[model samples]
Target: MTGSSHFPVRGIIEGFYGLFYTAPERNDLISFIADHGFNLYIYGPKNDRQHRARWREPYPDFIMKQFAETVAHSMNRGIEFCYSIGSGVSINYASEEDFRLITSKYQAFYDIGVRHFMIMLDDIAAEFHHEEEQLMFNSYAGAHVYTANRLFHWLKSLDKSCKLSLCPTDYHGRAPFSDYIHELGKGLDQEIDIFYTGPEICSETISEQDTADFAAAVQRKPVIWDNYPVNDLAMKSEMHIGPITGRESSLPRVCKGFIVNTMSQAEASKIALLTFAEYFKNPDCYEPWPSWEKALKTIAGEESYESIKLFAENSLYSCLGYPEAALLDLLANKALFSLRSGEAASVSKDVQKLFDYLDSLDEAGYHLKYRMSNYALRNNLVPWIEIMESLAWAGRRAIAVLRALENNEDITAPLNWLKESVSEIRRHPKRYTGSILLPLIEYVESKVD
Candidate 1:
């Protein structure tokens, strides 16, 4: 089966740096992607020791069994399971022993009916680490091209149908591409696919021109490793639950395919993946917000859709740059503007509207925290949920402080509560609603002193 999309290849890559998914979670995700029209699943989580740090070592028996099971399930679902190896950290490119180890690792997977493979050289130093490699090759790209070519030929020898791809060290940025990228592109086997992220590691936008420029440099169309919802490294505190944005509809015509890098939170990552599915199926007609809404409704179900929607709205700030807490921000801005005018009627209407929105935020938090039936999603979202609740409560108290002082009543109680809630919210490192609530708190503080 070719899977479901206008784009020939569209799927997920378990390529994040943190804790990888469990076997059941991965299998479930394979099913999820298969159902959503994704045709490929690349297994290459950085934290998978055998796949990365200890690239020369074999997977443990239990782990190998899991791989076999996953490959079988993915095949049954019509999704290609592409096993990947990240050996750039310490592979001796000139060493025949190292080459043997690479083939030996892949041979095991090939034995189990796996046919697609990728040699990921991303996120590693470009300089030759081994003396033998330094002596044999003048540049980083030269060494990489030699090793990757050997592996591609080996995989083809084992089975002519086997496919190979590479994720180079200089995977992002615009042309004038680095000499390393240009040389690697020109020298590598014509059939071996190369992976490219857009202009940045986590690109905000990927235009058709961007891919066209990259393909011109690489001498072949690239397989995009689009990194959006993956919240690893610097973005660990973020919950990237927004829709896929910044990718032009015309991308399918220019590039070979797409492989989305997902977040460690498998359940939460589905929200964005669902939208990605919509894009892949009909890029020309895709609308991020509508697709996102549909995904929320499908994943959260009817009973909890509104609550999940409210919660999701606050956490939409990822690399895609969607507004954080958009509705709450609008209401708060209106309320603050009305307060500045010193109009009692305006303040009463606007501030109350802001307060009501905050109340809804709090209510959404409570519903997801206590009653949402999807336990895995709830668990994945607990950190952001708690932060949202705290921010909502704190915002409410800030408004209360303003009201009590406005009424010429004692402000000590509300003021103290406001301080405590803000403190509690700040204690957690995760972000919710961005800085939209800060001005209200600042305004309240300025008046009291």
Candidate 2:
């Protein structure tokens, strides 16, 4: 790693901004981040306009005050807060009230010591806007920018200096981000910051050209909002982050800071924050990262990639269809997650024992340990199990079906799983325990033979 190209981060903000509404136990999550070395936490509110549910209502006065408590707690620990409002009112159509509402609320955040503001444009829409402009407006954070920049200018208008960050609709997080770097950084330089995630690795060796292209596109250093993979929250399968342990070593050397997005799954926020910290603080960060050896030690209790995968896969399975969705959201950070549940891994060889145990379950026709019983397993738990120590690809599909049943959610996925499970048992008699897995056996047995 070249010292010169790598703009050393003086302080780090291993962020886990909430994309959804606040979680019930947010108080615990905030305390965890401060204990770690995170400098910022982006509180981006979700749909709260309805003024409803437990935590779903708009940032209630009490909630915002509590949010302030977390920020103050972070400040005492040296962390900063970034208030990111919605991206809905970006175009010319939004009323002045929307502007007043956002700014006034934002001022509340400012009163709490937030130094940075991120305007997300892609989320807001203008019916009259063209796709290109729509994309561009999204990139610029639409009318929110009008409010934010107006806020920026207002603060500056009042001679107050503040930081401005924008998440465009596209570009910054795309494969072609570099192709439009200059444009992506337009009008938002000096004080403006770019926060983004992408479908491809912009910092990989093989994707050097793309990385370089992306680096050139932002015109200024961008902040990394590294996203963890997620399907549906209800599925047990959407549990783990992929094994990109080495990814931290490859981020664009030019990035100003990175916030490993922990989304709504705030409970495990500390785990994600710690992973990024270890990688960034240590120079040979990736080469040994938690050392594949030690990471493995925790993964399978015996230092091997296979053991680690099982720990992740099965744990994911256990978490499958867990309700409180807030839990599912945080568990998405599969990358740094350790899998084994009760044992302390003292050596690498122990992992084989763990897998062997799982294998024994499979042999005994005990598929619950696999995906058969969980949504995270994608239907046939075998596919997830076989690859637990090998792949996380099946996770791409949402936990559409099983999760619904798990959560007692009314979504179509779970209902269909039940209907299908019954017909499936009849069509394929060899699948489950004759006593338990049989289709509606109670209903079938209650009638005359």
In order, candidate lDDTs are 0.89, 0.42
- Tell me how far the alpha carbon of residue 85 in candidate 1 is from the true structure, in angstroms, after superposition: 0.9
The TM-score that candidate 1 achieves is: 0.97
Give TM-scores for every candidate, taking all chains together and pairing residue i with residue i: 0.97, 0.56
Error of 1 at 231 (Å): 1.0
| Most accurate candidate by lDDT | 1
**Model 1 shows how many backbone clashes?**
0
Off by over 4 Å in 2: 1-24, 45-58, 89-95, 123-148, 157-161, 171-184, 199-211, 229-236, 241-243, 246-252, 269-272, 287-310, 313-356, 359-449
Badly placed stretches (over 4 Å) of model 1 are 1-5, 343-347
1-449 per-residue lDDT for model 1 (tens digits): 12234578787899999999999999999999888888899999999899999999999988889889989999999989999999888888899998999899999999887999999999998777678787999888888888999899899888999999999999999979899889998999999999989999999999999899999899999989999899999999999999999999889777888999999999999999999988887888889999999999888888999999999988888899878778888998988888877844225798898889889989998999899998899999999999898888888898888878777889899899999989988798898888898898888888889
Residue-wise C-alpha lDDT for candidate 2, range 277-382, written one tens digit per residue? 5555553554433443343333223323343343333333221122222222233322112212322222223332333443443432333343232222223233
Q: Roughly what TM-score does model 2 have, to 2 decimal places?
A: 0.56
